[model samples]
Target: MKIKTLAIALCLFSLPFAASANPTLLEKTRQEQQIQKTHNAEREAGFKLTEKEVRAKRNALIAERNRLQRETELLSKSFSKNENKLAKLEEQLRLETGSLGELFGVVRQAAKELDTEMAFSVTGADHSNYDAVVNEIVAAKALPSITQLNGLWLGMTEQIQASTELRQVSVPFINGEGHQSVVQAYRLGSMGLIADQGYISWDGKRHVATPYLKQPENGPSVSVMSQLNESGLQAVVVDPSRGVMLEQLANSPELKDRIEHGGVVGKIILGLLAVGAVIALFRGVKLMMIRQQIKAQLKNPTKPGNNPLGRVLNVYSKAQNRSVEALELRLLETIVDEQQGLEKGLSMLKLLAALAPMLGLLGTVTGMIETFQVITQFGNGDPTVMAGGISMALVTTVLGLVSAMPLLLAHNVLSTQADNIRNILEKQGISLVAEQAEKAGSAA
Candidate 1:
């Protein structure tokens, strides 16, 4: 009974509390609903304002696109109209120009020619402004101006005047040693440039002159040039082909340069020639001395000296008392011995002569082989690439021929002398035999 009363008391207390909680919950729910309504109203107003602003921006962008399109069309029509007008004007200009068009073409062509000519002309060193005027004419987009035409005339006139005038001036110069300096040089019209050295090459671009590495052998000497400078009437050598002949002459190889190009084969050939010359000289002198001794012995046959003829005469004297047949045999033996001495070096000389040409042929073959190798490795577009082997071939052949000729001639002359001596000895021996036979007959 007590537990039921406690439970009833607890229910009564919870009922009042539940009633109070319900009123408070209702008020709070109403307040939340009112706040949500205010938020919805504010969101709707913000959404409406954002929608109006987007529509206005879209309309403005569309209007701007249409305006740009209209402007593009107007500009395109104006461009077409201007293009037609320009074409009509150009056609009218062409019709009115008539011979003037041809004149413009001729003027441009002449300007181009002058520019090209002046680029290589030696007078360019003195007058360089002419090139600028001619270049303006060449590169002109419109018709040449009268001022430019006058300048062109003046340039041509100046070039002509300079070509006729011989002037001595201080100019930039490069010597053979490649040292650059300002030196007094004479401009030989358009032909060449002369300094203390011989002919010098002109550089039109740098406006400088450089001496040729090698001057022409037949060209004027320094003394002659100095005299010409001092005396205007003195004759000076000038290249008729302007600088072309001078350049060729300067680039041409000298004797020493040719030999160097000929390489080892040429040197060998030269060495062989030298040796052959020495041998020939020695043999010639010995043979000449032998011939002299033989001639002297002939003049006095009785007195025997230490020469071949003296020995032969002595042999004859010893054999005089013997039978004629025995004496003849002794004289023949002595002559044979003398013949051996006289013909000692003749064979060697002949051999050398024959060997020289053969060596030259060997060099030719080798040089040709080298040239073929070069051709195989590199195509023959440039002749200078093959010049080395070709030079060796030609120079060696020349050296061989030059060496062989003199050697062969010396051999021939020496051989003739030797043969003549042998003939003299044989004749003397036969005469001795004849005299001995006659004496024997007289005694019998």
Candidate 2:
């Protein structure tokens, strides 16, 4: 019984110790969780406090911004009005600074109008009294008003003065100074005066500067134009759109004479061609006569003569009683002689035909040499100057070919026909001789 009681007491005591140890561990865990909860609450309280302070600050900033915006609007309106008033005052001051003449000038320019029927007459005592004409224009009431004529007087003065200067200028551009310029001025002035006015009529009453007029005949004016022979050169008049400088052409002796007389080479070549044509015409007439004679001989076949076919026929007739072989030999000899006579100058004609192209080539070479000379002399090297030589060369070549080709053809055709006719005559002669020889033999 004692052992049982001791075991029971020990069991009871161990159970209570185990139970107490578990409760103590639970209590420590509860303490740690309480500390964590306290720390979280404190942190949350601190964050809420900071958020409230920020909200208050933001509200105050919004109120301040609204107040500033309102003030800025009021200032902008005030500045705009001040700026407008200042700009107006500045414009008024600038207007006061300008002179009355300048103001009148502006108004006149703005109100001026153009009228078409304005008369512009140019009258000067000779070419030297141009100032009188300008003074007349200045005094005329037909011009624009003075206020509106700010530049009008200056412009009119220049125009009339320039017109007079141009009229007094040298006629052609022969001299160096005031040559082309004077010519151009004269031309433009004449045109301008005509356009500004209605028409231009030169007063025949010239001043002492001009000589007396030479009255022309009432009848047809005789042109002392020598017929210029331009055989080698081909020329065509170019119709210029701008007016021709006819006055200069009329005045320049050298230029006028050149136009009228043409160049030496052209004249010489033309004379040569004319002579050649005359000779050819005579030859052609002679050839026609020869052809007629040949035609008559062909039709009759009985005309006896020393001519080419005629001689051949005569030889054949003589050998009528002889053997055919002997007659044929005689006929052959006669035909040969006739052929030589017919072909007398044929080689010369051929030589002439061949020489045409060679002459053209010579012309080409000479033209090129001239072109080179021009290049060497002035070195202007203008294609227009060089083109003259080139055109001459090409024209000569074309002329040569044109002349030679037809002549060569005619020579060849005539020679061939002559040869054929000669051959036929010889054949007839031989046949007649052969027949006669055969008859003689048979008779023997």
Candidate 3:
């Protein structure tokens, strides 16, 4: 009974502690539930704020879409209205411009044709101010005014009148040397301009006349111009093709230009020719003198002089004591020595004659190579590109032929003279030996 009472007491005593523990656990549970409630309230508030913002953005987007649709509808209606107005205006324009349109078209076409013709016309050089009227007609968007039509007719009339009239006028001129000056020039009725110097070409764009680089043989001269000015009825040469033939004459190469085109080989060939000519002249003069000396010696063989035949006679005199065979050998040797002096420059002349043509051939080969290279680089489309090389080849060949001919002629003449001298020496030597042999035999 006492133990049970103690246990009951202990239970009673533990009841307050258990009650305190329950209160503590209840406070903790309440604190945890308060934290969870605060988190849920904060999450709900944030969701409501995001929803409001999204709703506002959606409303704004809906308004923007409506505004864009309204603007698109307005633009479409305006485009349709503008298209209808443009079609109406075009119909009205078509109805109002019926035959006038054709007339304007004809005028424009005539203006275009006239502009093209006038660009190449020599008369345009003096009447260049008419270009503005022509351009106005060509570029006119509407029908030409009566004034413009009259201006066009006036331009055509001026061209016709200029084509028929031969007049002299002071104009700006550029010479072949590229000097610009104001000079008195004769206008040959749209044919060409003739300055005091020569034929001058018209530059319609620059409104100036330029002289031809090389004037034609029968071209205008100062005497002809003077007569024309004095009489106004002189027969003067005119280019019927306006400037075509004149331009060709101006571009034609001169002799010096052709020589330059032959390049270094041509110069060398000419140099060789000069050298050969000098050699031939010297040798020819020397041979002539020697021949005269030999003739003199032939006239007076007994009196030996200071010459080839004289020396030979002296040898014959000295060798008279020797046998006939030995004397004959000695005379032959002396003739050979004279022959060597006579034949001095003949071989060099011959060599120069031979080498000139060979050098010309080398130039031809090099020029052809250059031509082929040009063709390879630029193709054979333009013939002028290849003309340089072709000119070089032909000019070099001509030079070669020219150089070789005279040298060859000189060589032949010189060789013949030397041969004649040698023959004379041989005959004289034989005669002297024969005379010596006859004397020796008589003495024996």
Most accurate candidate by lDDT: 3
List the pairs of residues colliding in candidate 1: none
| lDDT tens digits, residue span 143-249, model 1 | 89999999999988888888887777677987768798998776777777777777778887777888776666657655576676678677666788877887787
Give the TM-score comparing model 3 with the true structure, all chains together: 0.69
Give the 10-residue window scoring lowest on summed lDDT in candidate 3: 122-131
Native-referenced Cα lDDT, model 2 = 0.51
Give candidates' CA RMSD values in order.
11.0, 19.6, 9.5
| Candidate 3 Cα errors over 4 Å, as ranges | 1-113, 128-154, 174-181, 217-224, 233-237, 365-394
lDDT (tens digit, per residue) of candidate 3 on 182-288: 98877778888777777877776777777766777877965687787788787777779987997787577888888899999989999999999999999999999
TM-score of each: 0.77, 0.44, 0.69
Question: What TM-score does model 1 achieve against the real structure?
Answer: 0.77
* Model 2 residue pairs with clashes: 323-437, 324-433, 324-434, 324-437
Candidate whose TM-score is highest: 1
TM-score: model 2 vs. ground truth: 0.44
Rank all candidate structures by their TM-score, best first, as comma-separated numbers: 1, 3, 2
Candidate 1 residue 165 C-alpha distance from true site, Å:
1.5
Off by over 4 Å in 2: 1-242, 245-287, 381-392, 437-444
